[model samples]
Target chain A: MSAPVIFDPMTLPSDDNVNAYTFCVELKGGEWFLQKGKMIAYYGRIEFNGIGHGRFERLLRTSFHSPLHASDWVVAQGSGKMLLADRAFDVNSYDLEDGNLTIRSGNLLAYQPTLALKQSIVPGFLTLIGTGKFVAASNGPVVFMEPPIRVDPQALVGWADCPSPCHHYDHGYMTGVLGGLRSLTGLGGTSGEEHQFEFVGAGTVLLQSTEMLMAEQATGAVPHEPGVPGGGAGVPGSGHAGQGAAPRLPGQLGDLQRRFGL
Target chain B: MLAVDMSGDSVKAKNGSMVAYDGQMAFKKMSGGGEGLRGMVTRRLTGEQMTVMEVRGQGTCYFADRASEINLVSLHGDKLYVEASNLLCTDAGLRTGTTFTGLRGGATGNGLFTTTVEGMGQAAIMSDGPAVILRVTPQYPLSVDPGAYIAHQGNLQQHFQAGVTFRTLIGEGGGEAFQIRFEGDGLVYVQPSERNTIGGDV
Candidate 1:
């Protein structure tokens, strides 16, 4: 057996990836906003402080805008090279130039302080604004595709630039009595790909090769505003989309008449 | 998967790790990791027990463990300290023994005793992902999260460091409050994924 390559601070790349599953970020008396518990190792002098620390009040006010996710984030400061990885997933760093990118909250690993982090209006997503570098992890290699395409919800990783994203249900399979019956009860052969997320306008959509998703991070509850998607919804046990409320039998055909406005 | 061609020389591997083999091969379970009676007693008392088997043959033997990534470490007389569970196979000429590791072992949830292999031979360790080998120097000390640490070699001094303050009690402590600081010169092996450690929540 032979020893693997041993990397030192001098040999480690600056603000780049060490491999497909690990990324190295070099800090020269600067700071990076990191997700809690994502740091694997580091060399030199570096201090990790929670976002609620008193000294970071000003920094938090400027860049850290999502108060609900405060507990899951921290600020890494000082001079050192740190290694970040998540669940052995493929990690990559992207540079944003005075632009915004929306990503799944769990996929994001760390970002520069120059970028402002905010919760996206769409649930379970985060938007980073300004010009800086941010690291993200995916179950597999991420593929960049132009908009004007529909992507499976589980395969979508994120999107860069402005694009209108909305739900696109296959009207042919979702309308009519037979379509509704097929969806409500798996009779008459219901293809699982009847629904997708449609993206239009100009932007880049990121997709992972595998449909397996990383464990979803708690994005925190949105404000109880009237127009919010998940805000007006009550407790999870009360049931919003017919899940957890009751166990329907195989041939029950759940809410088919209501869906058809019969 | 690790494939080793053996021409009469034997190798000690984890029991039940042989996946497939071709040609001539003899598999025998070595009692007490082939370390005699004293090693058995020490391993039983220290709770660092590992069941190893000796494979000697004239053909090719394949070894695998749960489809994990295998890392090869070459040792030229320096001692390799690793968790018993992470050790897969080693040259039969190497000496395997149990040693006390104090607080660092407790932090990793691997007990207070660790397995040490020494000699001029090669050993294979298993990890969830490919291990990253980081070189530690006297000038640049390395601090690692306990959950991600796997093994280390060469002259190194490790200290189990903890940062606990009033903020920690209020759940506002830094997420990386518990870490293992390694100084001196050595090579540290870290997996890209973290195991659930005792100090993981802190």
Candidate 2:
């Protein structure tokens, strides 16, 4: 049976533009409570990103520190099935050391092109944050100024001409001491093979928070990889906790990529 | 970063032609005989005032600064247009325009100005998406985000109205209301969502 729609169109903001995209939720085992009334919303000028593919599930909540004027209205909400385009969501993400905000989403298409920054482009302060199970198709060409902003390994937009930061994700253990420290501090440090993606352009970065890889390890849900269709909820997540998280390097990346059809 | 300022100027766009403003104006003649109307609407001018007229076939536009004072027009071309009846100098922006800027405070009623796109380059209006000009027959359906509306298709027009007695508010009136009711058919262009907060978290 079709799930009954509950939204009152007449009740929507009078000035709002809406089409008859009516339908509450249509699923069997799909819990409506987990999905209904949940929508991503914002009151700012956000350009569009591209298409994306992956199992996505995140819960985010942000409240303003003070009563902001109307010029910048406060916003909240989330997404479930994200239809992102190519180049819309970069494979990697960046860490905005300055004014980056945390977010969770079902799909996030940052208008910021997921490409390497140009040699001339200076790495500025604005950032693009996203929180979802993102598996980008492009590794990226992150470009920026001499000393570009430090980018997070997992949270990246794109890259530049020549990429660097190929070092160990940590200075200590392959899976123990370093991994422990990384988790303890949430510091995405580096090592020999670890590379921090860089952007060398006049672009903004989108950001979000996710433990999709870790969540999968704990919940046994595999995410749908790019080339691989369906099921972003069964694989053993990367960075599994101590004895439980997915294994370290040597074979982990390959195994995950294979299952994800990368 | 999108903020709707209620304050702005109601400079003149003589039906069609498009032109720019340089803090100065030159008002021409105005009989103000809007087809359905019975008489010529009279007007008065202030310190800074002028009139403009876009002759029928001359496809061009004119402009004026945010504080330029203006009034009704004589049918230079397609005269009656827009979602509301008023468009003018008002002050309703995020930051009141100081000496550097001028915002005629208050919201202009919704409606369409027949000026060329250039005439509207600096003009902001609410629409469904890329505005679709319609023939306004009784058959076609016309709908739009009250916020994206510029004008409707007929003499039957509606602009920004205050109060929830006519609408339901989630928190409070967005200050932007819903459905600028238009009985006949017309056109509207608007972004995918009037309340779209996509890339950044507002």
Clashing pairs in 1: none
Give me the overall lDDT of model 1.
0.90
Model 2 misplacement above 4 A: A1-71, A74-128, A131-262, B1-38, B42-80, B83-148, B154-179, B189-202
TM-score of each model, in listed order: 0.94, 0.28
Q: What would the per-residue lDDT of candidate 2 be over residues B150-170, giving only the tens digit for each residue?
A: 432223333322323321223
lDDT per residue for candidate 1 within A208-232, as digits (tens), equals 9998989998888789755566676
Which candidate number has the best lDDT?
1
Instruction: Specify the highest-TM-score model's number.
Output: 1
Q: Is the docking of candidate 1 incorrect, acceptable, medium or high quality?
A: high
Q: What is the C-alpha DockQ of each candidate?
A: 0.81, 0.01
